[model samples]
Structures are given as structure tokens and as C-alpha cells.
Target: MTLNRRQFIGTTATMAAVLSAPMVRAQGKPRVVVVGGGAGGATAARYIAKGSKGAIDVTLIEPTRKYYTCFFSNLYLGGFKEIEDIGHTYGGLAAGGVNVVHDWAVGVDRDAKTVALAGGGSLPYDKLILSPGIDFVEGAVEGWGLSAQNAMPHAYKAGSQSELLKAQLVAMPAGGTFAMVAPPNPYRCPPGPYERVSMVAHFLKQNNPTAKIIVADPKPKFSKMALFQEGWANHYEGMIDWIGDDFGGGTVSVDPNEMTISIDGEVTKVDVCNVIPAMKAGRIAEIAGVTDGNWAPVNAADMSTKADADVYVLGDASSQGDMPKSGFSANSQAKVCANAVRGALTGSKVFPAKFSNTCWSLIAPDDGVKVGATYEATPEKIAKVDGFISQTGESSDLRKATYEESEGWYTGITTDMLG
Candidate 1:
């Protein structure tokens, strides 16, 4: 049976819609499967399950039993937090009626509307949400790969990586060198690498005072650039050297075996090297065939994928415009997506999608800076409406207040995401 391309596409679209309908499932309740239990996935699953009142079946799949948040992980290096401070579990979601599955989502069969697990089964769903966060771009850093991570830890994913990097930092010889190969733009947490630099500097000042910290940044300017520079000058003074693109910081390579880094043509031996490479959406997004090579394009209104309406992508994995890929942004987008998904399945009252995000970075003790914005769903993307940032010359009291505010937000958000 020969069919025209248009006819075949149209026929498949109709079949997909019919197969994705809620009534087709044997459970009789519409099923939503969420992958990657981070800020976005956890919040969305919790919201949907809590809001639907058992009218919808919600499931969350995550490979890790204890999820470690990348946000605030820098504090652990600076001796401000313990690893347990950022770790969370899925018990709250399970208690909230969400079917929490501790397994990896290996494949997504959109036509069959089922998610394949790494364990051994497939779970059917009417809708699927992916918020798998950032994975490093392959070969983004020369002479570096996952195999070399033990020597030059990225620590970008938190957990063991963070611990490894901290151990290396602590073991640096007196007056030794510490170098960071910062990632390029459009990566997760714009200010994250810089914050890590600040935290590292704070640690060196207290423990290994003459030890130098150097940053090789691909971008000429970074998030809160002026503020970070101001804080660095005030606190760490001659302890840090920042080499941006103008100084050949963009061209970098690392030799993990020799504990050396080459910036432009200058090879220098360092005691510890933190290499953060360019990033892409998590592997699952690409596996689902919804990514535009690097990230999954999502509609701002509901965080649904442009490729398939039944599939949604969130957080660092989603290419939604005007929002920096941060935990706050993910949590904001998740609520909007959860409301829309619940409304779609249960005919509940859906609010207009309004989103907001605030990212806070601690420069030193009681010295914190922040940037934030509110966003609205435009037809094209999630467009920024208004924004704010902490000033460079802010008073110490104001800075302390800002730091305290961030602490409060951390406590609030963790509970919000987990419970």
C-alpha cells in the first residue's frame, strides 16, 4: 500500500493522538511519567499528584536514590555546608501519592507512549516530562574526557564530583596553584562556575593562604561580573587571577596526567585543575528525538516540547528563551507546567503561566549577590518582564541581609521541591 508522505504523516498524527488519549489506558486514570527527579521533575510530579487528588496517575523516575542539588554545592567547598545539606530523597513525593520509581529512563517510545526503564519494564503514559539537567559536551575541552575526571574533576554535577574536587583543593601544597577551566556561555547556572571560584578562594584564604587561584573563562564577561570582581578585590585581593577571553582564556587544554594546563600556548603546572566543559541537554532528551541537537525546545506556555505535545522538557534540558538555566528557573517552570498538565488531564482551573527566578551567589562570609527576573509566556518564548541585581558597592549590612534571604529561600525551596 503506497501512501503519499503527507498522508502517512497525517495518519500517524491521528494515531498518536488516539493512542495518547486518557481513556485508552487500562488504569482508567490518565498517567503522567516524569523523568529525572531534580528541581523541575520533583516539583512537577508533586504538584500534579497533589492537585489531581488521585484523578491522574503520576510517576517519577530517577536513577539516584539521593538527589544532590548543584545549587549551593559551592558552599560545601567553602566549608559552609555539608554534603548532606544538598541531598534530598523521594520519600516526600511517595507519601504525596506520586509513584516514585528509582530507575533510569533508558528510552522513550513516543509512538507506543511508553518509557523504557533501565531495570526491565516499560511504563505507559499519556504524558511524559523530562528535566534531566545538563551533561557535558563531548570533547569540549581538549585532552579531557570522562576518563580523566578523577584527575581533573568537573564537579559540575555535584555529589561525588564535588567531594572529589574539594579533596583535591584541600590537598594542594602550600603556595601551590589552582586553575579552573570555566565553561562557555548558555550553560547551566551562569554564575555557578564563578561562585565556585569565590568559594575556592575563600577556602584557600583560610587554610592554604599563599595558594593562588586562577580562572580561565571562555566568556569575556560573566553573570554578575562587576560584582564578582568587586568582591574578589575586596576579599581575596592578590589571591586570584581572572583570565577572560581577551587574555586567551578561551583557548585552553589540560594534561591530567601531568597536572598541567595550557592557556593559549602557555603551559603551567597546577596542583588542582577544575575543568568544566561546554554542556548539552541530558542524554534522555536526545534519545527521545525531541532535542535540537543540544537542547529540547519547549513552548513557554506549558513547557511542552515543540517536537511532541505529549512530551515536555524542563530545566537545563529545555531551550526556553530568556531564563538562565538555574534551579529557581526550573522550579518556576515546573509549577507552570504542572498546572497546565493537570488542567489538561482533569479539566481543572489552569492559571496563566507566570514565571520567576532568583539566583544567589555568596562571594565571602556574609557577602552575597543576586540576580533575578520575572517572565511571562509569550507566543514565541518565555520573555523576561523585569529584573534586578545586587549592586557592586552595596553596604555590608545589605549584603548580609541578602545572604540571609538566600538561606531562607534554600530552606523554603527544598521543602517545596521535596514535599
Candidate 2:
């Protein structure tokens, strides 16, 4: 029978609750509860339900109706992609016979193996996966908070914030200055801020050529530094000035009301400011009592929490070694977790754990650079067994091919995660 929008939502939520109850397992099916349907959670839920072939019931809890990928978001700023290009839906996952619940997982009762929802429901599960990604540290940048987002958009989450930043750039006054407060190391997407700088510069060169870009980076060095620096010089020469820690980037603060940012005790008035604060594991992982400090420590082999084997963590929230926090890394970790979870629940033969990740950064039109590695599970962590990165001054043809490869990968990965 066809149902209206309200009825459909109500009926699906009821089905989610029933399939998530602990007693459902006594009906001869193990329940898997996955929180935060992004690269990690979506991939894990899809793999578990599909691999089990109905032997296990999978439920995914994500607050957003549509998931916008953080990867390639810089491309959005560069006008390389439209907003819809980066957005995905759970309709594919739901069609695969998984319960897709759009609700916040506000709490986790580890002792009871249940997840407390923001909408007044509890989901019981034999196995739990948390991939809630990152949350900003409260005091990382003084005078900057959620309330001031409109004045200085971070655009790190890649949706409304992205649109706001793009509009600000377009509306920027001639010869106006744009400043970026880059996060410290070990944050999500190491090369991301630099790529954003490149994209913003690409936009300004044509629209507002006299507009200047300033970067306040706390790190003395960054991922793909040589490549990005070279590309910046070639494409947007003299348009970008990157201030590193050695040059007082470490001592910086923002006055959002005044539209000014202080660097090394010198405050500069900026037409726009993008402040990317320090990040930590999402709250639900901490609520689950799985976090060790800023991130949840997990076994590299299976993405299972070190504190509790039955509960797993993936993506930016996980402190698994040798992998930067990117969509590629999360998707890789989720596959391993899916295999292990399926084995535990269905007595399936588990394969040896292997993972790989490649982060591609678009410096300019058809000029892309990348860093990637093959990883293997070890006693200590997910150690990098081999790696590769683009070199400075690469030929234009190769860089163009690399950029093409990134486009293809984006299409392939989004399909993989959403499906």
C-alpha cells in the first residue's frame, strides 16, 4: 500500500525500532547498528547486510537526510562541481534491505549494547559501529563559535557553509583580502586546507585579480607542501601568502565581530575569514565511552574499538594508525570492519585485512597532486607498507591525467558508499 510522506516516515521508523530490538536476534537474525551514515557507516551497513544475505539485520542511524561528502568540496569552491554533485542519499542503502533511520544517536549504553536516539527511541544490537567523523575543539580559536559561522564560514562540512564561502568570494570587494586559519596536524584531511587555498585563489584570479589570500597555518610543514607551493607559484603567482608557524602563524586569533584576524600580535582586517579549528572525534563516540583522548582508539585489523571488541569506530573518529583522516581512509576501514563483523555474526570465512587510501588535491585546472599508501595490519597499528606522492614540477599531461583520475574516483567512491 502507498503511504504519504508522514506515514512513510512513521512506518520506516517503527520498522527500524523493531529490527533493532535485542529480541529480534532470538528470531534467528543478528542485529548490527551503525551510527553516522557517511563513508564509513554507509559502507559498513551496506556490506554487512549485503554480505550476510539476510542472515543479519543492519540499521543505520544518521541525522541528515542527505550526506554531502567532504572530499572534493574544494572542487566545489573552484567551480569544478555543483552542490548536488557531492550530495548522496540513503535511498540506495535502504533499497538494499537495510534500515536507514534518520535520527541523531544522542547516547550509547555500552553495558546494555543499545543506542539512545535523540527522537526518544533505543536500538539494541549485537554489534555497534560509530563513524560520526569530527567535531571542532571548543577553544581552538578564541572568539569563534557556531553563532559566528555566518560572519566567517568554515565550510569544512561541505554544504551550506560551502555555498556561503563561495558567495562571499564572489561578492568580495576588489583588492580585498581573504584569510584562512588552518588547523594543526592530525585533523581531518591533511592536504585539504592547502587545496582550498588553491581553489579560492583560482576563483579570485579571474573574478578579483587584485584580491589577496593569506594563510595562517600553525604547522611548520604540511602534506604535499612542495607540490602545492609550486602550483601556487605557477597558477596564482604573488596572489597567496602562506604564513607558517615559524613566521608566527602559531600565535593567531580572530575577532569575528570586527572582521579581523591577529597574526603574531598583528591584527589584519580581512573581508573574509575561514577558521578551521582543531578537531576531535564526534560526540557519539565519546558518549559510547570509546574515545581515548581526542579520537577513539581502534584495532587496525578490524576497525573494532580497543576498549570493546563488539563496538567499532571508523573514519575521522578512529585513531587507527598510518592513515590520514579522509573519505578514502574511512571507506577502506569500513570494508575491513564489515568483513570482521559479518564473520562474527554469521560464521562466515573472514579474509585477511588489507587497506589502501589515496588523497588527491586539485591545485588548478587539470593540475592535481596526490599522496597514497598501501597499509597492512600489524601488532602496533596499520603500518604503511608502501606509498607514493606527486613530485613538484610534474608534466602537465600527467597532472591532467591525475585530475581525471580524481574525478573518476569521486564518482566511483560515492557510488560505493551510497550503494
Candidate 3:
């Protein structure tokens, strides 16, 4: 078989199974094994290691050497950000005295509190953090699965998939129709699909002005719906169309072979389809028996799983309430989890858990809007205490400021997660 440079890079992106500079821990340090290394797991590992200052033995097991942030990937699609800007490596985390293991966590023995790696090894952990991120539920959309991903890229998880989707968009024919099969609620980035639509429109406006966008959304109202809708109409006008649940967004199917999507019993052929299907906890969380079918129900105080307090789940894989599944939320949750884990292991002072998340979406160049909230952990869930969202017709200066703020946030978050 022949492979191009991109394919070669993707395949070789993950390091060899054998960890080269094995960590030698001092006697009886509390062991923390982190599975998955995106915003959630990476932040947890880094914080646990840095806060402890050699007091905790932290091992981060992530298959990929570099993780691309799902945040601002839409900006990459919109040409505001570069691919390299979104991708980060574990080198910084390792330099901070973390044991970064490039290997897939295949299994978990909850009773033994051990993680099984695909590289023929097991890691014993006093505390385990599983931030495996999102995985599409099989058959979530009729006639769609991982097998059809090539034809209809989800690109929800970043890295190679994001690159592939961008390539597909760039190759789209002029005046072609771009279709999106938006996921149901409780998925990562509540505003992500709409933000994607705006970015795609931004690209098409500059490259192929006549191109159209179609969104099939299962939800009636989404985060910052009025803001996004107002922006779409003001900017894209007739170039964009959305079908909500009232119009059969809930009963939609796609056939990648035919390049057709069915909505409300009407089938339309589309040139490019981005199918963001129903999502669930990462496979490893389910394998660990920590998930309640779809997501790991974590205690709001520390993001610890109900099935096992020793195992914590974060990011899109977790079902903690009030906080939307977003990079900001994951990073916030990771801090709380880190403090709790540190106190449990090293007798360090633990603070009360407080969380916050802000989701920013760009409609056009320098035109941005945001929704954010602060939360306090209740006995049942993370309840929202206060919130704010951009108005439908905010000033251009404010929008530009919001966009600028998001840029700074992207930089801060990547550093927090990777380092």
C-alpha cells in the first residue's frame, strides 16, 4: 500500500510503545494514572504533578504524542488560526516532572485500581483520571458509523480528522451544498456545531460565495441560539439554512454512499457532509465500568465517578451537570479534581470546588459572541450560580474584543493543559 506524507505523519504521530525514560519514584508516593491527554486528562496530570512537586507519582497514558485542541479548531477552519496553533505536545508536561506514557489505555481493573495499556503493560494507581473525550455512539445516525467517517467526517475530535475535514471543505465544488448532521444535546461544546457552521460560511464566502450551508439540528434551542441565528442572517443571509426539531431534525438519516441526507422524509444530495453524531464517554471509561451507559456520572465536588471514587472522569466523558462539555469546563473540572486528589493522597490543603465555562463562537472575521457561567457544586449536581451571554446585536468593537479574549483564552488553555 502507498501512503502520502500526511498519512505517514498521522501514523507516526504516536510514539513507540516502550516508554524511554522510565520514571523512578521515591518510596510510597501516591500513584496517579491519567488516561487520555486532551484538555481534561492532560491538565489533571500536569496539575497533580506540579502541585505535588515530586510528592505524587503521576503517569499520563495517552496514545497521541501531540493533542490538537478542539477549541479554536473552528478558527483554523475559518483561516484565522493555523493547524500548528491548535496542536500541542507533551514535552512541556514531561519537563515539569510528569511521566508521560504514549500508550492507549485498553482496560481498567477497578477493584485492583489498575489501568491496562494496549502496549502489554498495566499501571497501578491510587487515583485514576479518565478524560478519554468523546466517541460517537454506534448507529446514532442510521446508515452511519466509523466506517462512513471518511465519506462524512465528524471532525469532532481534533488532529488528523480536523485536517481531513478542512481538506474536504477546501475541495468542495463552487456553489455546492454543505450539510451538517448536528449531534444531540449533552455533547462536547454545546455551541460547537453552530460555530462550525459560521466558520464554514466564512470560508465559503471568501472562496465560493455561491455555496450554501444546511444544518439539521436535533435541539429546538441551542446555546446562544439567538446570537448565532442573528449573526448568520446578518452575515450569510440566504447562504445558510437551519432545520430544527420541529422540522424533523430529530428524525434524520444519512447515506454516505449516495452522499444524501434525509430530513422530514425529504432527501437532499449534498457535496460535503459533516456528521456530528451522538456522543458518549470515551471507550476506556465504559470499559472501566465507571460510566452510566453513556457518560461517567461524576460527583460534582471532585469529578469522581459514582461507580468508583478512586476513578475520576472529566471533559466530554463526564456527566456532571450545569457545566457544558467544553474545553473550559474540562480545564476547570481538572483543577478541582487535582486539588481533591492531592489532598486525598498527600494531605495537602483542598479548596472548595468551584467551576466555570465560557463558550465563544466566531461568525465572521472579528465578529464573535460568547456565553459563560459560574457554578457551585450542589449535592446533586453542579448548579449554575450566575451567567452571561452576548446580546443578539452587540457592537462590532465588543465583538472584536470578545474574539480577542477568546484568542488569549486559547493560548492560556493550551498551556494549562499541555504544561
Scored by lDDT, model 2 comes in at: 0.92
Query: Model 2 compared with the native: what TM-score?
Result: 0.94
Error of 3 at 325 (Å): 0.2
lDDT per model vs. reference: 0.94, 0.92, 0.90
Write down the RMSD of candidate 1 (Cα, Å): 8.4
Please give me the total number of clashing residue pairs in predicted model 3. 0
- Summarize candidate 2's per-residue lDDT along 1-419 as a digit string, tens digits: 88999999999986776655433555658889999998999999999988988879899999999888999989999899998988888999999978999999999998898999999989999999999999988889888998888999999887889999999988899999999999997999999999999999999998899999999999999999999999999999999999999999978899999999999999999999999999999999999999999999999889999999899999999998999999999999999999999878766768988999999999999998999999999977988989999998789999999999999999899888888
TM-score of each: 0.94, 0.94, 0.93
Which residue pairs in candidate 1 collide?
Answer: none
Error of 3 at 206 (Å): 0.7
- Each candidate: RMSD to true structure? 8.4, 7.7, 11.2
Rank by TM-score, highest first.
Answer: 1, 2, 3
lDDT of 1 by residue, 1-419 (tens): 99999999999986776566444555588999999999999999999999988888999999999988999999999999999998998899999999999999999999999999999999999899999998999999999999999999999998999999999999999999999999998999999998999999999999999999989998999999999999999999999999999999999999999999999889999999999999999999999999997999999999999999999999999999999999999999999999999877766778999999999999999999999999999999999999999998999999999999999999999899989
Give me the displacement of residue 153 in model 3, in angstroms.
Answer: 0.3
Ranking by lDDT: 1, 2, 3
Steric clashes per prediction: 0, 0, 0
Q: Model 3 Cα displacement at 330 (Å)? A: 0.5
TM-score of 1: 0.94
